[model samples]
Target chain A: MAERAQRKIPDSSRRSERSRRAIHEAALALIGEVGYAKTTIEGIAARAGVGKQTIYRWWPSKAAVLLEAFLDLTGEAAGAGEVGGEGESESEAYAIPDTGDLEADLKLVLRATVDQMNDPRFDVPSRALAAEGIVNLELGTEFVRKLLEPQLQLYVRRLTAAQATEAGGVRRGVDPRIALELLVGPVTHRWMLRTAPLTHEYTDAVVEYALYGLAPRP
Target chain B: MAERAQRKIPDSSRRSERSRRAIHEAALALIGEVGYAKTTIEGIAARAGVGKQTIYRWWPSKAAVLLEAFLDLTGEAAGAGEVGGEGESESEAYAIPDTGDLEADLKLVLRATVDQMNDPRFDVPSRALAAEGIVNLELGTEFVRKLLEPQLQLYVRRLTAAQATEAGGVRRGVDPRIALELLVGPVTHRWMLRTAPLTHEYTDAVVEYALYGLAPRP
Candidate 1:
């Protein structure tokens, strides 16, 4: 097993990683410039200075390439906050903090989300992909399942942890899944529709409205 | 004033109305097939069997044409439910029925929404426009202002009414605007993402989850 693992890590592995990063950047840039339907595998390969087979060997389709590229982008962004000496883990890259203070924790994460949404680096490509997702169900579901749901589940975990705590943390009967939507949905609506500007203020409002009922608390 | 109003209704005006309806239908059809960016005023006029000047005389842009076309379609749908009784104003056509039962009213409207979301006639064209809106901010804001917000406001009105009532109803402190998002956002999320099959059952669940605090009720 050790020998097989060593063999998998070829001397060319570092070159492969560089090629992969180029391919991902090219995919995102192309999708952002031209819409998704017009973005072809050959186009991405040409932009990346890579042979088409290199991308094909890694991803089956353009959608797969874009999805993985986005995933990689999000992972890198999340990794920036890593407290050194803990060694990076997948959980550190994706996990929502469960600080026992559900409200404060949720507020912190949502504020970060507001900042991300405002950043053109994230927004432009995401909007392009989302535009495609609006019309393409197969692609939409794949992206949602792989990218969106995992992030949403982190909220679920945080909410569930809140539910488990003694004293009135979260209401017991609350389905964490649906409850999380109350937090996420409004922000998404604002972002997708461009009905309003997304800001820390707006996200803070959403967090407040979701946790404490919009109706006057008795 | 009445004589002037009558004189304004020329024979050409009547003919223009017919041409306008035809143009709207053509725009919707063409957009549904080729999508918004590819959909053109000339194409719409050609499909409608009208002169390009006829379309130009009526609307400034293709976006304006599509927006009016959608508004007309919604108006027609709402009209079908009207019994054509005396004093049934235009506002009545757009208003969500307040049957004094907020939950039931919301469910009925949302169930109808589920049907509309599933219907190919509405879904196909809507997806095309929505896809364009995702990337186009000015067009998107126009859509939200003219179309989406009016519909959302109906919920705001209903929630406000519920809050005003003395009986067990929405809490007064609840901002009707934000309160409405709780109900609308999740359904939109499901429909837009195709995360799951949208059904009356799912909408019912959203309403239930929203109204009865997810946390255990005292």
Candidate 2:
């Protein structure tokens, strides 16, 4: 959250924690149903069963509420059982597994992403933010920088490791940042545009195509 | 247009043509300025100096006006001087140049696509439609089927030709439909998310990586 809770007695602190979770749940549900344009702070508060002031005191605006809600959803979705150290957000704890098999690791993570995209809990609210972000530059850039880029960076980190050490690794001439997109962009494009069904089979093909060239090998 | 004008004498036909052009211009400008949600038929008519009745006479909704306007813009941007046959829209005339040199041909098309994404004439209105499509299934699916899928098929056609004959052509194992996404997706993901500056240099690299494979050549 942008603002921290004030010093409080134990009883009140527990109440505040409950309110925060409720507000996050409410924000997610509301955005899923009505989209960002139609979603309002008052509406979120009403659905959350908290006072309007309660929302404002914790968040600066509706966008903030949705963003925090999204972050929370992403955290729960990243339930790999590893916990972040105190003061580390769950996002920090999330990392692409470096299993030494680049192809295997990528396929595993990408299949999980496909599953997340299919999950309405993440998909609906994510679409709300992505739609709004397309038209609203500030919000779009914020989410990309704060949320999306980090996830993409995990791919970069993995590919970079491969380039440095693996046999038949990613080409050294390639930029890991751009190369990561080859894997990510196809899955995301399919999901965002609804051009085709996003499936484990499709993602496995993407991984196969990206790692090995399309052209016949010499 | 969804509705054809009533049978017109030459003088009236000329005037109708002028009104159609004006409405197209108005729709493009208004959607860019106000976005899809705020843009309205009354606003478009007011800007075009046509009666609301005149607009309603031909198009069913603002979405229709914008779709045609977009088609016209795409046609103009595709000003390769090859006009479609009678009764064929310019979209039909559009094709990935088959120079039989797959790499050069793809680079040429991707470069043009990058130019199109940067052109505010197409970019602004396209984003408006895309943003709306994320949340509105009917419109999203309609635009994809009518506008985007046809264009993507052009790439599929080019790739299929490559697979058939090029010496180092696409491997027979690769699916042309999925393969096209690897080429198209990265450029698009970067453009839509604003993660990085989309340049000819970036697209060149994408083509290189997608064709050659990120994995080192054996």
Return the top candidate by DockQ. 2
RMSD to truth, every model: 6.3, 5.8
Please give the fraction of native interface contacts (Cα pairs under 8 Å between A and B) kept by each candidate: 0.51, 0.89
Error (Å) of candidate 2 at residue B67 is 1.7
Clashes of each: 3, 0
**Candidate 2 Cα misplacement greater than 4 A, ranges:** A1-10, A81-89, B1-11, B81-89
Instruction: State how far residue A39 of model 1 sits from its true place (Å).
Output: 1.7
Tens digits of per-residue lDDT for model 2, A1-218: 43456644468878898999999999999988988888999999999999999999989988788888888888787766346678986567887787788999999999999999999988998988898888789999988988888888888888999999857378787899999999999998998899999999999999999999788887
How big is the RMSD of model 2?
5.8
Residue A91, candidate 1: alpha-carbon lDDT: 42
- Computed on alpha carbons, the lDDT of every model, listed in order, comes to 0.81, 0.87
Best by lDDT: 2
Q: Tell me the spans in candidate 1 whose CA falls farther than 4 Å from its real position.
A: A1-11, A80-93, A165-168, A216-218, B1-16, B80-93
What would the per-residue lDDT of candidate 2 be over residues B57-147, giving only the tens digit for each residue?
9999988888888787877777663456778766778778777788888898889889999988788878888888888888889888887
Kindly report the docking quality category of candidate 1. Answer: acceptable
DockQ of candidate 2 against the true complex: 0.76
Residue pairs in candidate 1 whose N, alpha carbon or C atoms collide under 3 angstroms = A171-B215, A172-B216, A174-B214
Residue A108 shift from truth in candidate 1, angstroms: 2.2
Evaluated against the true structure, the overall lDDT of model 2 is 0.87
